[model samples]
Target chain A: MIELRNNELIFQFPKVHTQAVCRIDFQRTLRIPDDNQEYPLPPGLGSFPINHVDDFTDNLPATWKEHGGVFIPMYQAEALWMNFSGHYPCAIKIAAGKINAVSGTQWTKKLSNRPQDYVVVPDQPWLDGFNVSKGCVRQFVAMPLGEGYTAEEQLTGDAEHGGIQIIVYPMKHDVYVKYMEQHRVFNIGDEQCLTYAPADEMGLGAGGVMRQEIYEDDYGIDSWDQTSGLRCFVHLTNSAIYQKITGHPPLHKPPTAQEYTDSGLPWFDYYADKKALQGSASLSQLTSVAAKKIQKGEGTLDNNENVHPNTIKTIKKGRVVRDGRF
Target chain B: MTFSSYIRQSREGLKAQDRRFSVRQVAQRIGVEPAYLSKIERGDVAPPSEGKIRALAEELNEDPDVLLAMAGKVSSDLLAIIRKRPKLFAELIRDLKSMPDHAILRIARDVRDGDW
Candidate 1:
C-alpha cells in the first residue's frame, strides 16, 4: 500500500517484507538535512498524487486493472526518483507508462531507450544512460508521462497514462539467506539491507538539493535482480483500490520542449554550484523580495532560489544555520 | 542483441517468413496485453521472464535458446555453471561466434576428435 507522510511517499508490503519510499519534491530545490535523508529517491520538482489503480477503474484500462497497483500523475518532462528500503530483501520492478523502466538491456538498447526511464545505481548515481553497471541499479526515474514514446497512451487509454506504476516482489527468505552465504556474510541484519551513496556522489549536491547525507558504506549486491531470490514466482496482488486524491491535478497535457526551455530550468545539473551565492549581494536582495512575496501568499519558495532573504538575515544575525540551508 | 529487440525482430522476421500470425494472436497465446507485448518488442520494458520469452518463441516459431541468451539469462541447470566460470563462458561464446557454422557442425558431429 502507499502512504504519504511529510511529503515522503512510502510503499510498504509487509507480506513481502519490503518498503519503498521517495521524498515527494513538488519543487526541485527542497533541501533535506543529513540526519534525515534516508532513502534513495532523488530531489526534483513537481508532486503527483499516488493511489491504488483499482479505485479508478473507470479512468484506467483493463490491462492496468490487471497490474492493479499504485499510479502517480506527472506533467510532461517532470522527473522524479524512488528510494527503496526493505526489512528483508526484494527485487523491485518500476513500470513507467506500464513499461519496465529498469532491468535488462532496455537501459542499453538505443533504439527504444529514452533518457526519461532509466536506473541509477550507487556506482553511477546521475543517469547519463552511459555510466550504467550491470546489477547495482538502485534508483528508478519515471520521466514525465504522456510523451509519444512512453507507454502512457496504451496503458491508461487517452485520458490517463500520465503517471507511473510500481510493483515489488520480496525475495524468498531462503534465497536471501543463500545470497547472504554466497556474499561471504552469514546473516542479513548486519548489512543494514540499505546501501548508502553520499548526496555528492548521487549528484544531489550540484544544484537540486543540498543534502547532508553521504553514502560511505557500499554493498556489492544488486537488490533489483528478479532471479536472485526465486527462480519462479507470482505477481504480488494489489489490495484493489485506485482513487485519485487531491493535491494532484489531472494531466492537462505536458509542457512542450520550447516552453520548458523558455522557463530556463534544466531537469537537473550535477556540477553547478548553487550554494556559493550566499555571499552574493544580488542573491541577498532577491531573498528580501522573496520574503515579501511570501507574505503576499504568492511566494516563490519552490523556485530555484537558494534561500529566502529573511532566513539569510537570521543566519547572519544568529550565526547559525537557519532553515537548514547552509 | 537485447531480448526486447531480439523478440521484436524474431516476431517480424518469422511473420515475414510465414504470414500466419498477427501480434494480437501471439500476444493472446502468450497471455499478455497487445500493448504490453508491443512494449516488450520495443525494448520499453525488461524482457519478461523466461517463461514468457519461451512462450513467445514457441508462438513465433523461433529458437528459444537465441531468445534466452539475448534476455541475459540461462536455464537453471546452466546458471550455476555460468556463475562459477563466467569468464570461461564469456570467452567460449566469444570464440564460438568467430567459428564458421560448418566448422561448428563438424566439431559437433566428430565427438571422438572434438576433445570430448
Candidate 2:
C-alpha cells in the first residue's frame, strides 16, 4: 500500500513477510546506523507534484489513458533512498520506464529503525546501461504524453516508455499474518488493509507484469516553472525484481563488481548531466508563457507487419504475391 | 596492465582529448571525490565497483568492460548468464578449451543456424 503524506510516499507491506515489511518510506530520508556506519540519507527535494495524464487527454495519445500514472520529476544527479521502519520484511522492485534499475531488501526485518538496504541513483541507470552521467535514463524519460521517440533515435527519443514504476513482491499474506499474529502485531482488518496471495498465485505468472507507473510531462514549463524537457527519476531493481523481470535462472550469489570487471567488454554511462544538456528557461519574458507547439510525428508502432491480414482479400483472377514472395 | 596503470592511462587519454575535463570535474560527474579518483588513478586504492568503472568509462569515452576486466569484474549480462546456468557454462568452457578454432566455429555456426 502507498500513502502520500507530508512530501513522503510511504510504501507499507504490513502483511508481507519481507524485509522492510513495515513501512518503507519513499522520498523520505532517514538517518539509520548499520553494521559498519551511518548512511544519513537526505530528504527528497521538494514535494511530489503529479499531473494526472487523464486531465490532458486531448493532448496525449490514446495509450496514455490506459497507462494510469501521474507525471513525476527529478533533478539531475539528485539521490533518493527508501528507508524502512517496519517489523516485516518486504522486497520491492523499482524500475524506470520498463528497464530494471536496482532491487533488494530496503532493510532487514529487524523490528527497529535500522535500514536494511538503500540505493543511490543514475549511477546504475538501467539494466543495459550504467553510469549514465547526463540525462534521465532512456527507459524513464518520456516525451510529452503524445510525443514518442522513434526506436532508432538513441540519445533523445522524443516519445518514450514514461514514468517511474515500482512494484513490491511481498511474502505470502497467510505466512505474514500468522507470523505477525504470533508476534502480537494483529492489526489485520484495519481500514484499507491488503492481503496478498502466495507469490506464484498472485497473477504475476511467468512474465511478472506487476508494476506501478509514474508518468512525466514532456512539454511546457514544469512545477519549477522551468522549461519541461527530459528529467530523471530514481529507479531501484533488486534481486527479486531482477528474477521476475528477466527470468534469469536462480543462482547462489549475486555478482561482485570485481567479477564484472574481469570480463573484457565496453561498459557505457549515458547520464544527461555528463552530456550537453540544454538549460531550461524560466518565464522571464511574457512571450515565454505562450503555449509552444512542438512539431511531433504520430506514434508509430515498431512492427514489421503493416497491412492487416483481415484487410487482404484473396483474388483468384490476379493471385500474385509482390516483393519476391514465394 | 594493472588496474591502477590502466586507470592512469585511461585518465590520461581523457585529458589528452579534452584538457577541460579536470580530475575534479570528471570525479564529480562520476559521483566520486577528486582525492579518491586521484588515488584510483595512482593505484593507491583498489579498483572501484562496476558502476563507478562504468561512470569513468563514460567520462573517458573508454570501453568500460575492458576496465572492468582489468579490475577482474564481470558485466551484469554475463553475471546473469553465469548465474542462470553455471554447470552448463562450466562444461561448455571445459570442452571449448580443448577444441580447435575450426571446430568451435562449426559449433557456433550450427548454433546460429538452429541446427544444434
TM-score for all models, in order of appearance: 0.30, 0.26
Candidate 1 CAPRI assessment class: incorrect
Candidate 2, superposed: residue stretches over 4 Å from native: A1-326, B97-109, B112-116
lDDT of 1 by residue, A214-274 (tens): 1111232243333222110111111121123323445343343234334543322222111
lDDT of each: 0.35, 0.34
User: Model 2, residue B33: displacement in angstroms?
Assistant: 0.6
Q: After superposition, how far is residue A122 of candidate 2 from its true place, in Å?
A: 56
Give DockQ: model 2: 0.01
Instruction: Return the top candidate by TM-score.
Output: 1
- How many backbone clashes can be found in candidate 2? 47
For model 2, fnat equals 0.00
What TM-score does prediction 1 earn?
Answer: 0.30
What residue runs in model 1 are displaced by over 4 Å at the alpha carbon? A1-47, A59-63, A98-167, A171-326, B1-116
Candidate 2 residue lDDT tens string, A223-326: 11111111112222222323443344322231221232233212222222222222111101101000111123333212211111112222221221111110
